[model samples]
Structure formats: structure tokens, C-alpha cells
Target: MDTTEADESIKYTVLDNLLVDGKEPGSWGTFITRSEMYTQAAQMNGLISYLAIYIGFVLVVACAAILSIQQLSNVADGSRSYRVLAQIGCDDRQIRHSVMAQQAVFFLFPLAVGLAHSFVALKVIIELVSIFGNMSIGGTVSLTCAIFLAACGGYFLVTYLMSTGMVRAAIAIRYSE
Candidate 1:
């Protein structure tokens, strides 16, 4: 059946009435209509999207926490190195810049890997979705990318701030000793 020829509004109204009357397959032992099937499919898609977003947020936060802890530990362990750099005429600004750069690489590596995986997975998902209909996924994909980037940027900012403070304190302690 051609979707263009199908009267969706009428079908929606009929389906709505059927749902209101509790005449669905389990409710009244009636066969499910195409309209009802589409409704269920859309609802499931929404649920999955929400679940994915929540999981992505959790992963981003966890990544940031892990990176922050690692950076702080490295600063403590490498305090002697920073003192050596200071002794060699490296200013505090230079030391801070080096620390920030190192943290940036640490934060970006996992994000880059995750994005690579997402690109491949999204390509497969788009192909699978296209089998059902000629839907345009470009907007959805762009939005998802933007959201992920924003989360990553936020985490990077926080990690950089925390690590910078830790590095400064470590350097000061090393110099005092």
C-alpha cells in the first residue's frame, strides 16, 4: 500500500477510537491494526532514545571522573619533574600550560574512540531504518552529535579546572621541599 495514498488522519481517528474502547489484541482479543502497530513502534523508539541518552550521560560523567583522578595522581607522582622544569627556568605559566595540554589529550582520546564507534553504529542503524521507510536521519544524527560534543566539552572544562589546581599545589609543595 502506498503511504501517500493512505488516509492517515482517518486511520488515526479509527485507531484512537479502537484504543479508547480497549479493543487491542490483548484487551479484547482483536487483531492489531497497522495504525496501532505504528504507534507502538514509535513509542518504543522514544523509550530507546531516552534510555540511550541517560546511559550516555552516565558514561560521560564516569569518564571525566576517571580522567580527573588519573591526572591528579600523575601530578603527585611527577612533582619532581615539574620542580626540575622550574629549576630549568620554566615559569608557572609554562608549567600550567603543559599540564593543561596533557589533560586535554587524556580527555580527548576516549572521546575520539567513542565517536568513531558511534559513526559506524549510526551508519548501520540508518541503513536498518531505511528498510522500513525513506526517513531522513540527518537531523537526528546531527543533534545527537551536538549533544555528545556538548557533554564532552563540559566534562573537559571541569577536568581541566580541577587538574590545574592540583598541579599548581603539587608544584608548590615540590618547590618548598
Candidate 2:
């Protein structure tokens, strides 16, 4: 019989054979074939991955917000220095470049640390998954890294734009005075 027929016919003759003897009695027990177990596991993995991606997106946005706020505050705090630099003949473009450079350095460290942790976590996942059968996570790792980098780039771009706007406003105010 095919798997469908066999699955329909599967019946446990005795509970003792499946469960350890002298165990706590329970009214419910689930028996599934290897194939069924594999299918269920795959489904669970897919669901978990979707949820993880959503959570990651939320975290990336949160990081971007925090960075943007901090950059704006820095502009406020460094207004005098910026004004001095402007008086020293630094154009708005040069000031913007300096601000972006500082922000990039601040962002890069956290990005690197996060990537390292992800790589380590992937390695662990690959090792653990190998217990069941040979599994390759190389492609998965590459794809994940690419997506992460893209997300980071998006966040960086948004933060840079927002920060430069604040700086430009500050510079305009200085020019007015």
C-alpha cells in the first residue's frame, strides 16, 4: 500500500510498546511516522523563519530610529563646533561629509558585531542539524547575509539623510546670523 493507505491504517495495538512501562498514565498519545514527523518539522521551520524575519525587520527599524535620534542630538550638542568650522571656511558639503563619516563609523561597529553573531549562530545551527542528516547551510548563510547587508544599507541611508537634513538646517541658521 502507498503511504496514504498505510498512514490511515496505522493503529497501535498496545500503549506499552510505544511508551515506557510504568510511566504516568495519560489519555492522549500521538503516533506519527517518520515522514509525517519530517513534514511537521519542515512546516514549523518555515513558520518560525517567517516570524524571525518580521522580528528582524522591526529591530532594524528600531536601530535606525535610535541612531537617527542620536545623530540629531549630536548636531544640537555640536552646534558651536559646526559654527566654528563654518567660520573656518568649511562648506555645508564638507560638514555633511564629516557628519556622515562619523555616523558610518558608529553604525559599522554594531553591524559587524551583529554579522559575527549571526555567522556563529548559523554555524551552530548547521552543526546541530547535521545530527539528523547531511545538511548544507552555505547557501542559506549567504542569502541571509545578503539580506542583512541590504537592510543595514537601507537603515544607513535613511539615517544619513535625516542627519544631513538636521545639519543643513543648523548650517542655514548659522548663515542667517
Candidate 3:
């Protein structure tokens, strides 16, 4: 007999013979075919993978937004400092460069720390997963890094541009008076 017939035969035999408290096996427990089990596993894996991707995307966007807001607030508070630098013979280019450098450090320090942490976590994950089978995540890591870098770079650029505008406006207001 083919596998399907064999499976059905076995299933029927088990259901007929296996009894708990004078009831069929279906009443007390669950019964599923092998194919059903595999299908359920696949569906669960897909759901977990999608959730992970979505969470990662949300975190990246949230991090960028928080950093941008913090940087903008600092610029607002330090408007007087930029004005002082301007009055003390620093050109607009020098002032802008100083703001850019400060922001670069501010943004990069957290990123460096996060990357180091991620590397350590990834190493642990790889070790654990290797027990099951050989798995390669090099391409996934590269793609993730590329996407992360692009997102962060875009945020950094926007933050820098906004900060420069604020600085310029602050200086202009002082001069206009």
C-alpha cells in the first residue's frame, strides 16, 4: 500500500484499539498527521520570523527618533554657546563643523556600543544553533548591517542639517538685534 493508505490504516487501528477510560483517543487527547505537524511548524516559524523583523524595524526607527530629538534639544539649549563662538571670531563654517563633529561623536558612541553588544549576542546565538546543524548567517548579517547603516546615516544627516539651521537662525537673530 502507498504511504497514505498505510498512514490511514495505522491511524484507524490505533484509534480503535487505544482506549482511555472506555473512550476513544480523540476524546482525551489530540491526534494529528505527520503532514499536519510539519505544516504547523512551518506556520509558526514564519510567524516568529515576521515578528522579529517587525520588532527590529520599529526599534531602529525609535532609536533614530529619540537620538534626533535629544540632539535637537541640545542645540536649542546651546544656542547661546554657538552665538558666543560666532562673536569670538569663529566663522560660520567653523561653527557648523564643530556642531557636526559633536553630533558625529554623540551618534557614533552609542552605535559602537550597540554593535559590540550585538556581536557578543550573535556569537552566543550561533553557538547554540550550531548544535542542531550547520547554519550560516553571514549574508543575513551583511544585509542587516547595510540596512541599519543606511537608516542611521539618513537620520544623522537629517539631524545635522536641522541642527545647522537652528544654529544659523540663532546667530542671525543675535546679529539682527
RMSD of 3: 2.9
Colliding pairs, model 3:
none
lDDT tens readout by residue for model 2, 1-177? 997566646634444355555563344555666678878988987798779877887887688678767867887788778778888899888998998898888888888888788889888887876766466656765786688788778878887887777777777788799
Give me the runs in candidate 2 sitting further than 4 Å from their true place.
10-28
Error of 2 at 76 (Å): 2.9
Best by lDDT: 3
Task: Give the top-scoring candidate (TM-score).
Answer: 3
Task: Give me the runs in candidate 1 sitting further than 4 Å from their true place.
Answer: 1-28, 173-177
Each model's RMSD to truth, in Å?
6.0, 3.8, 2.9
Q: Write the per-residue lDDT of candidate 3 for residues 64-132, one digit (tens) a residue.
A: 889999999999999999999999999999999999998999889988898898889877866764564
TM-score (C-alpha) between model 1 and the true structure: 0.73
Better of 2 and 3 by TM-score: 3
Q: What is the RMSD, in Å, between candidate 1 and the native fold over all Cα?
A: 6.0
Superposition error at 10 for model 2 (Å):
4.3
Query: Which TM-score value belongs to model 3?
Result: 0.79
